[model samples]
Target chain A: MANISQPSQGAWTRMLPNSAAAFHRISALLTLAILVIAFSFASPAFLSVNNTLTILLQTSVIGLLGIGMTMVIITGGIDLSVGSVLALSGTVTGMMVKAGVPVVPAMMLGVCMGAACGLFNGFVVTKMKITPFVATLGMMLIARGAALQLTGAAPISQLGEAFGVLGNGALFRVVEMGDNGFPRVIFPGIPYPAILLVVVAIVASYMLRRRAIGRHIYATGSNEEAARLSGVLVDRTKLIAYTLSGALAGVAGNVLMSRLITAQPSEGVMYELDAIAAAVIGGASLMGGVGGISGTMIGAFIIGVLRNGLNMGGVSSFIQQIVIGFVVIGAVYIDQLRNRR
Target chain B: MSQTLQAAARFDAETTPLVEMRGIEKHFGGVVAVDGVSLDLRPGEVVGVLGHNGAGKSCLMRILSGAMAPSRGEIRIAGDVVEMGSPQDARAHGVETIYQTLALADHLDAPSNLFLGRELKTRFGNLDDKRMLAEARKVLATLNPNFTNLKDPVSSLSGGQRQVIAIARAIYFDVKILIMDEPTAALGPSETAMVADLIRKLRAQGIGIFLVSHDMHDVFDLCDRVVVMNKGKLVGAHDIDEVHKDDILSLIIKGELPTDWRPRNLGELEAAR
Candidate 1:
């Protein structure tokens, strides 16, 4: 646990403590232990390799959104519009692809649509002095309306096989060693999108830990007036944060559409709460100035695993919600304890 | 007074002064802060400004540093009159002010704070961090050797180290006239001694200094001349060698030398001491 402290506090050596961060690492390990133990007792299916893959796949979409939310929260802002933006962007991409646009252009247009929405939110928050919630809430309605209007409140289906490959494809054939007659190979099957999520998480971790701009973002979040007095471009920093969050949300929505082979206007209706909760559970503070991508990834995994394990144990969907809600509350209370110390 | 004489005698270089402010006046809202105050600062000289509360010492220095616009005044730097519209204007005209807080960001280290608002950039438009770190080390070596540990964040530094960083920043920016407000206000004896040494080092570099402080001991120890202000008006200017601590106290409180103020008899004062 103490060894892992080096990575956590090395990024902000002065602001945090090595021993204090070690405690957080210990807490994370303890939670993982509890998950493994509980899941092992819940159902035999929860311990299977196939079930683990399902958990990873389920986490990928929310994990992507959580990464961007981490960055936004670190810079002292929130994007309530991300869920609606995701639906809108996915709907637009699905419509464009149905209209004979190439897969590449559709994806590009979808990403641009998300970035444009974020830009509008950024402008309102920075230029007009609107608070983050109010500004992104306004964007939430606008994007929701646009999504419904474009889809006529119906799901757009028949996204081509090539487009669906991003979410549903396995890069290589799965091989087994037993008498199932699946030829054994050096490697097993891996989802391309899952690999992509891992790559994105690694890149985000590197950028946040090793870059000067990353330091500036933390500084702005810690004390905006101090950061500005030190000549950091506060407005520009916030704009970039919000824009990146929107783009990530767009990517998540696209991944979902690619998986389902359709865009539902009702998709991602309340996913923002789940994404925010995942990030907070992972150690991000709503008050800002803390948390990272790696923590958020673990947080997403926790939620995904909980859902999968609960379902396998015959828990009802409503009960699952209640359980997750309690988990969110508990995670936040622990985070507060760590912070106060 | 004798100590001040010895300090001033060491730095007296040329007859002509470096900075001259004539009839400086400033008004804030409906109130007049500085009324017709004139001052002259010579090269390699330490000039102290003393005043009671609301006596316009800060207002006058702010005008000098271009932090504020003087309602009326004429400032001459190196015998040429100059106009100041902003703090940047003061920097362009070789004037720098070091406030009490030092204005160094706690999260940043010495090198970063040394170039805070004006960071050095590489050809690719990124921060020239390597060059900045090297230059910071060089400046610390030349100015304050104790500050060679520049890698530590400013928040971890002591009061003396923070003060040194502020002074080093002014020196790096090529400030000809340094305006320091209460440089050692909260320092202990040793820390204050270190700052006094830094002021002497700056004086040796041929920079003019306008020191605003209420400490007569520091003024008597470092300043060559002292200017006193009372009730938003200039009280009087005195060569530190020609005046005692009582004279400054009297000037600050009453806006004039105390009546019946005379040097104590040496035998009796020595017995008391």
Candidate 2:
């Protein structure tokens, strides 16, 4: 036991390059770079500016949800109802807009509704003493049912052009030379949804790395008993994490609705899985207390690139799903190996 | 014979105790873990609690530390009765506990662990990592001068280093009374000596210490008074200079005072010295 308690000299040398967390993040970035290079070589369209924008736009919704998922996972908890909550939030906004409500108010109400759902989950998990997995699982069913009930199981379409700008509009358009030396319209208009993703990622990363609440979150996840003994309000921290996740899900729902110009009660079905996968691939551990936003963003990009490249290369969506499933498992396996060392 | 000695250790107006736990009782289901055990600790004093595995020493201390609530007890800190509903409550009243497990977040670095729940923040309300790191370095330097790797997570640290960090945390927040449960249980000889010196330093600063341990030598070396418990009941309380090691051993094992002994007064103790 004494020998085990003392770290070996060799282990110190191995850890010198970086801490274990840094190592995981570096490996994640390396994997993403390799994928980008490989995909660019495999498909001519993969490296195009339009295709790059498409990937970022595609990743925006899931990326926002992944940021929230990263926070939840760091506290050693899971929010399985994010997709359902997103669907319900978007459906509510669509229904309100159809009933002649202004777009901005409708979107704000939708976000609030999403936060309310999260607060409910927090109450169930913290106040009622239910496990996070079970509480969020129940919320998943409830939110999905609520979405269907609100929309009468139909899709709400024909939202105004103003609402669509939140998802489809781009800014800072510029022209540049293409790979073939032809003058191409390189309008690098940044999508609003992608902008939202970047802003959320920056805020979340700053909170996790430079804020007291963020430190408390990590401490709470790492060891609840210890945090409690150290005078931390563990319940409040968890409640905030769940609430943030719910609100982000709402934002994702709005982005999806605007991008498609329609809101369906089933629009975000199975999206929670993708969000969780992105966070995990970015190095967020299911066991909690070990993840960050940057890693999660990279993880989100990795998934986005894989899906876009595979589709362009004529790979079936079924095969893409299999590959994604294996990637999630592989990432967690590597995490376990790192922990064991 | 030790009963009179126990009675003499009771609080008086002239020397108010730093902490006084009166009639602490804890029950789990039908089993009584602690049965009306009362203890007192004075400033700049070390009170060693000695007991068998199931003798209720931990339960009594846990109640004082606010980790567990006593079924019935009144805790007075500095002559004022206070409620200990949670560890936060205890800390608010200048009470801190160093648990046997150390209660450290293994994923966090030394500075983070030192300010785990109550972190110092900058003017902008962000965590002031630079300030915390500097403070942690000062604290760690005083405890263990050889410890310099403040960036590694505690999981990567040795048992001794971890113990030092735990101790530093307890003392950093202006602790008036510290409850240490088996602090040196996992340390080597040099590490143990280091802790012993730290304890003496704290004692010099007028902080009260409640040390729960099974090591007889530690009790003899560091304690001013020794309290023995067995089967959920306190058997004896003796001034270190007034009782023999065999007397404490007999009380711990049999839950009874020594047969051929008489409680001696302070003057008698001085004469014996």
Candidate lDDT (C-alpha), each: 0.79, 0.89
lDDT of 2 by residue, A1-341 (tens): 76885667457557635587777788888888999999999988899888999999999999999999999999999999999999999998898898899999999999999999999999999999999999999999999999999889999999888778788888776768888999777586888888889999999999999998899889988998998889889999999999999999999999899888898899888999999999999998888889999999988998999899999999999999999999898888878767776
In candidate 2, which residue ranges exceed 4 Å CA deviation? A1-16, A173-188, B1-13, B262-273
Docking class of 1: incorrect
The collision pairs in model 2 are: none
**Best candidate according to TM-score:** 2
TM-score of 2: 0.94
Q: Best candidate, lDDT-wise?
A: 2
- TM-scores of the models, in the given order? 0.73, 0.94
Clashes per model (N, Cα, C within 3 A):
0, 0
Which candidate ranks first by DockQ, i.e. highest?
2
Model 2 chain B poorest 10 in a row by lDDT: B2-11
DockQ of 1: 0.18
**Model-by-model DockQ, in order:** 0.18, 0.76
